[model samples]
Target chain A: MRILEIENLKKSYTTPDGEILTVIDVPGFALESGEQIALSGESGSGKTTFLNLVAGILRPDGGRIFLGGEDVTALSEAARDRLRADKIGYIFQTFNLLQGYTALENVLLGMMFGKGADKGFALGLLERVGLGDRAGYKPSQLSVGQQQRVALARALANRPALVLADEPTGNLDPGTAGKAVSLIKEMCAESGAALLLVSHDDKVLGNFGGVKDLGEINRAPRGGIEK
Target chain B: MNRENVGGIFLIAKKSLAQHRLSTVITVLSVALAAGLVMAVFSIRDQTYDAFTGGPAGFDAVLGARGSQLQLVLNTVFHLETSPGNIPWEMYEAIKENPNVELAVPYAVGDNYRGYRIVGTERSLFTDLEYRKGRKLTLAEGELFNPEKREAVVGSYVADKTGLKAGSKFNPFHGLVFDERQKHAEEYTVTGVLEPTNSPSDRVIWIPIDEFYRISGHVLRGGGGTYEPRAGEEIPDRYKEVSAVMLKLRNPQAGFLLDQTINRQGTAATLAWPIGRVMAELFGKIGWVNNVLSLVAYLVVLVAAGSILASIYNTMNERRREFAILRALGARRGTVFAAIILESASIAAIGAALGYAVYALILAGAAVVIRAETGVVLDVLKPGPALLAAPLAMIALGILAGVIPALKAYSTDVASNLAPLS
Candidate 1:
């Protein structure tokens, strides 16, 4: 089953200097169920833009996005948000856990905006991430790797069908970065969610089952545009 | 909790508030104090007005030396203000002779025992007068002062403060103030103590009318030449005077006749009919004071709301990413907006609820001073307009104050804010 299918996807933004900058113009893309694929791009390749378009976080200038065969791009902004909440889990480069909430609460926040947050399941997710004892610790209290593990658990919190990650190990040292990538892949595979991770680090890309280059797939002019 | 669950907005706001615990607590307490102050101001003003307008019930009118009716009511009815001047004893006798008058009691006040008013009157003042509608004065201890003897009937409050019980003797100062040097040579025994009437009557030290005139310093200002009475000399009726005369009419309607007959035409006295109306008018006269106090109360609430706005807005700049994270997680923009508004209202709701305690504290403090000054004991638990409405208004204002910050949160850009902090 195809978790996500996109065709003729395009996005652009006007520069502060008033010139139009085209960043992403991908002709086609598809990810199979539970398949983890990595996409690499230099800084200006608009890799994050593609993830955002697929996650329904941003509107494509023109395209269609089908998640589980349902056309998401045709939905209203609010409806798209609903679809994203119910079907997509996103992991940021730096762990975006709420500083005030406990580690368990951060994971629960994923399920919070979805159907509901089950305390027991959230605790189990924390335990699976090996931070069950530190469930009560805030993100500020956890180590860098531990925080990422909590984020990984949170990403799978809603039992998402597709997971989009943008430089998930960008902040980790090379050693911890390798471990974090392995943990992310293992966690995503266990949850049976298709994974699309974007990164510039070759070490991080080398761990994925397959990798794609954003520069080759997205046909927009680079213009040193921000990803 | 933001919006989906029972704990949505409150739970999330609670966590957010906890993250800035010090500022949150400070803002809440400021709001509490403001709510309390506003409620207290309204309460004290209203109850004080009620106490004054709801003065002692027995007297329908007060006849005093020709002067301000308010001064007469204050001096004669409330034991406040000095006597406007002295009315001749003949005026009391003349009003007493009216067929419409049920009873006329005279009061001659010029001295004080330890700052409490010393009111001299006939025995009929206590025996025949009712402090409330159907309640005559009762003695708490000892018997009523002998009408012809040198005896004092202490009011309950005077007795409590001065410890003036039966067999106690005290010299009166020359005026309505405490003075050791100006004490009269004559001393009077406390013959009785009055039960608490919760009225001005509770603050007076009552004595015989004859003794008040014979206190050695009263001048015979009647038709007779001014003659300072010598000891053992009897002051003639033609030489006697009373400060004010309280009249209980055969019916309340007859007070209008008295008001017409003496106050309207005769220059001998001023008649204050409908005593409560007189006090109400007195309250109206001092409405500027009420307006100033109310302004202060409203200002405090405004400042409290402003503080809440400042507290929430101050941290808004730093929480953009947090909002973005929630947005990306599936929170609708309205959810974050409502959450911010809900947080502010929650702070006010908590503060306003606690405000009643602060109201109790303030009212309790104000009660002591009010009772001392006006001799009226107020029931603190009495309900008024401020009881419920003020707190609700505070919450509404809190929500209103949250709008700007909530709008800021509503417009937070998820894509930009989620960009890694460089």
Candidate 2:
């Protein structure tokens, strides 16, 4: 079954010049459960915008987005938020770990919005990410690779059906990036969660089972201008 | 939300506050200072009221020469002022014999011992006078004065200062001053020292009313030179006078009737003033000052609330990204809003605790000073309405202050915040 499906998705932004800039226009897209796919794009190609749309953080100008068999576009903002919290996991390129919380607390934070969050389960995820010993360390105290691993642990902590990772290995060295990518894929596979990874780096894209370029799928012009 | 989620939210707020140590301490201490000032004022106001109303226990009315009623109570009861003038001794005897009177204690005031007022009354002043409700005077070391002899019972404070004990003899000064030539020829031996009553009575020396009349300077000035008695000579009974008569009525309702009778029917007329009404009027005259003080205290609390608002509001810009991150992590906007509000409330709660601590310390110090200076014991632990209201009001104000910042956090755009990452 498809964990995520999008039909005629559209989004736009208005410029200071009073011209409408369409940032995303996708005719169709689908991702099967338990599948991992890479989404590649250059800067400003609406890769992040598509991810935000799927996560219900931003409203699409026009579209039908199905996640875990529920129509996201038909839901209210609040209902979409509840749906996202229950079914979707997002990993930012910046790691975006709360600076005030410890590594273990960051993982626990993902499960807080959902019912029946377990502390031992959060600890298990941290152990799986090789951060069990560093659970008490804050994000600032961890290296870039460790912080990214903590973020990956937190993303999978809620056991969501799909994970959208935007440049998960962007800030790491090549060796650490390969290890982080493997960990993300391995953790998602273990949880039976589909992965939609966004990256500009071909080396990072090479590790995924399938690949799609935003330039082809997004019908919007390169500079958010009409053709 | 589940229990875990609530605990997690509190943990986040605690960690967030800890992350900004200096700002948290500054905000908390400012609140503490404001609360402390308010509590201190309330405590002092309560102590002052207690001192005024509770000092003149057991006495219903004061009958003295026509003058300021408050002055009469102050002079006869608290020993705080000089006598206005004396009523004739015959008038006191007439009032003492009245059917409505329960106890009538006459006072003869004209002399001082080293600045401490020397009061002349019957021995009943010791055995009958009541200070703080039902508490009669007791001798700490010696015996009560003998009514027929030249003996004195010094108050605790007079004894403590002058080292006067039983059997110590001293000559009384003519008036409040200490001129050697003005010292009366008659001498009185201290027979007792009363225990500390924590009232103005602690600072006086009591002598017999008969001996008081015999003192050379006791003769009324306008009663003619024939009333003057030579040293060691006996004075005529018609020359005798007493400063005031403190009456405790059999039925407090009879005070008004007795007051009318004293002013209208006595051989030598006097005014009977109800002590409580006189005190209430005195308090009413100065009540506005307390209101103004209380207003200033509440304003301090308002300013403290502003500090909480400013403290949280100033940091809201930097916290937008943090809130955005929480939203992206599946936290509802309500969670973010609640966290901000809870953070401000936590600061206020802690500040109020510290404020009460500081208030207790201040009251402890003030109690010592008040007891030493005015002989009025302040009960620091006495609970008043302001005790509960002050801190609760502080927290309510704190929540109000948090609203502005919480609203800002709630409206933060997550997609815009995460755009830079892409």
Candidate 3:
């Protein structure tokens, strides 16, 4: 079953001078559980833009985002938030863990926010990522690799069916990027979640099952994968 | 929302606040200091009024050779100024003998000990008084004045200062001057030391009217009196003149009727209703200042609240992404709004409480200075409406402060905030 679907989506920004600049135009796409896709393009390719639209973090000018068969684009901001928390998990390029909370506490923050009843599950996810010993340390105390693990733990804390990662390993060392990607893939496989990874790094392309150029599509009419 | 659920937002707020330690401390301390000032002022008002009325049932009214209402209140109610007339003891006797009168205590006050006046009245002045709390005046130590003996009952404050306990003797200077010839040349034993009432009564040395008279009359008759222990005189013949007479009416409404009756009868003294006079003169005269003070207090509180809002609003610029993250994690918009309000409310509450406590400490510390200077006891704890007035103002301030932050949090655009932090 298709866990996510998108129709023709459009997004624009109004400059301070009142000029409307079209940022993205994307045709429909769908992804089923356990499928990993790499969205690749040059800089300003709108890979992250498409992910934002699918994750319900940005409202497209015109489109429909169907997540788990629910039209999230038609929902209110609060309802969209609910949709995001329940079905969409996002991993930022920079692991934005709240600076004050400990790593385990940050993981718990996601679960505490979600409808999940098992708070300890956040800790278990950290253990699964092999950073259980660093749970008490804050983000500043953790290395880039450890912080990414904590971010991933938080991402999977709600067991969302779809995971959207924007340059997940872009900031990591080449050796650490390989480990982070493997861990994310392993965790997504274990959970049977559809993973949409947006990155321009050539090293990431061959690791995924499918690949597409967002630069070709994002600048095309309605920005579809097939220009 | 369930409190358990609300706990999550609070946890976030708490963590965020903890992260910004210097900011949080500054905010809390600023709030606390403001609140402390408000609270202290109110506490002083309470403590002052508390010691004044001593729970309200203490004295009825002052019957003096009334000139001005404020002056009469100052003299009789507060024992600060000297009453004008002698009011012949016969008039006090008449009121005491009246069937309608409950108790008529005559008072003669003029001499001072280190600036605190000595209030000479009949022993009934202390004994016949009943407080609202059902507590009677008992000597903290020693016996009440021996009626026939030339003895005095010193208030706790007076005893505290002079270190004169029961059975200790002290001679009175004939005048208010510090170094003056002793009048009537007799030592009066302190038979009792009254409990500290924290009122004007606390500062007074309560000697018998006869003792006050003997000293005053001797100064008049002998021309130059010294502490020469006069010939064995059981009760000095010169103990008749007094300063003023205090009349207690049988009914409160009867105050006017009694005043009419007393003044019309051409009595030696004048009649005054203390409560009526206090209401008319005290507030009437200072009402504008009080109103201005209230306005200033409100403006100050408003400014404090504005600063709080400004601080939160300023922080919100940096916190937008954080809120978006929270919302993405399933925190409701209301949760975000409430967290901001909670932070402001905490500051306000802490500030109010601290301000009140500071106000109390000031009053308590300055109690003696106030009593000695103005003869008005400042209640550092049991304040009047001013105490209540302060927190209500702060709460209003809290609400005002919370509004801006809450609205900012509510209007936070999650979509733009979380805009693909690439």
Alpha carbon lDDT at B288, candidate 1: 98
Model 3 residue A203 CA deviation in Å: 1.3
What is the C-alpha lDDT profile of model 2 across A1-227, one tens digit per residue? Answer: 99999999999888889888888999999999999999999878888888999998888999899998889999987787777777888999999898988998888877887644678998999899998999999999999999999999888888999999998888999999999999999999999999999999999999976999999999998783322
Best by lDDT: 1
**What would the DockQ be for model 1?**
0.46
| Model 3 chain B: ten consecutive residues of lowest lDDT | B220-229
lDDT of 1 by residue, B1-422 (tens): 43444344555788888888899899999999999999999999888788788757468888888889999899888888988998788878888999999999999999998899898999998889887878999998899988777799999999999999999999888887778777888899999999898888889999998888788777768654786766566777887788988988898779878888887878878998888899988788899999999999999999999999999999899999989888888887877898899889988998899899999999999888988998987767999989898999999999998999999999998888886421
Q: TM-scores across all candidates?
A: 0.94, 0.92, 0.88
| CA shift of B380, model 3, Å | 4.7
Kindly report the interface RMSD of candidate 3, rounded to 1 decimal.
5.0
lDDT of each: 0.87, 0.83, 0.71
Candidate with top TM-score is 1
For model 1 the TM-score comes to 0.94
**Number of the candidate with higher DockQ, 1 or 3:** 1
